[model samples]
Target: MHPALVEEFKSVDAVIASDARTAGVDAFALSLLKVERQARRFVTYLVFQYPCFGRSDVPALRKTLSDSKKVYFEGILRGFDALYPQPLEALIGAEYAHLKARVDEAELHRNKLFHGQLTEESLSRAQLLEFVVDMRRWCELLCDAGQQELGYAGFGSSSFTKSPELTMSASFRIQMQGLADYDAFIKTVLRRPQGQQAQ
Candidate 1:
């Protein structure tokens, strides 16, 4: 792992794990806040990862749309979708096809978190734990996928494990393969209808 990626992993994972113990409303609220943060970084990472961004004439995309934009996160996500076209899971693997749908669901949650009030809602420790795990999993998966899809081969798999004080520890690992899947995977990420990026 490069020092910079290691640093980013610690910073993002900590926010996801920090409120895993509040056990109720606090956990739910904090998890929402932290996941929002993680998702923002995740979107930004993918945009910068785009092959076109490194071009000398092209400028990096802004993470935000505008100061008055009501839905900051979802708007940025939409912008990426317009540019990338294919599902991000295409970078990870076929088994993760549902990951795109999950991303959509999470987007809805993000909107609610920002616009709606959370008062008088029923939440449990189990639910809180689920949120914590989801946020961490999403971030970890993206980190691994980013490297495998855009980075040099042979760096090995990217993984991160988080263990709350006494609770069962959770971990995720993405081992990137080569050659056999390379052509197919790149086709998906580039949204190559005929072995070329959609124009």
Candidate 2:
């Protein structure tokens, strides 16, 4: 029900519809389950990677990702927004719902962590590992979604196969690199303090 989730859901639905069309499926049934799964994967990754993210930071992160998602969705929506009209529009709507639910859930989980209701034991190292793995998976999914949309628009897979053009524009590459930096930061935090260095 959160606006962030709503935006992401819409973006993802647009992406899937775009893919299906490109794949040449005529009557694809929009799968809310799949969209929900994708949304969960994304939120889980965010929460796991940035447990320290505060309410103040949530808006910025949500805004940035939402804007990115919208740009990508619009790009795909441009050519096929009218084709198969009903399904395309439906996909967009569903994605919005999916993302909204995800953002709401994530905010709740984040609040729990912030309030000390959650503990490291409650979210183990394995969970953190899984979160990173899922993050990579979601990134791949987003990339694939873009590729699929392009494919639907008559561009071959190759068209979308290269590194995302958006990722390189205007120091976005630095932002992307920050994802890795964040992982290192987490690892550093998990380590024993230098004063208590392990023998």
How many pairs of residues collide in each model?
0, 10
CA lDDT of each prediction against the hidden true structure: 0.41, 0.34
Tens digit of per-residue lDDT, candidate 2, span 83-125: 2222333443435454444433433444465476774346543
Quick one: best lDDT, which candidate? 1
Per-residue C-alpha lDDT of model 1 across residues 1-199, encoded as one tens digit per residue: 4444355445435645566454443544554454445444444343334233333412213322222234444444443354443445564465354544554454455445556745234445665456555544554565566555434211222211111221111111111132223223223332224433211
lDDT assessment of candidate 2: 0.34
RMSD of 1: 13.3
lDDT for model 1 comes to 0.41
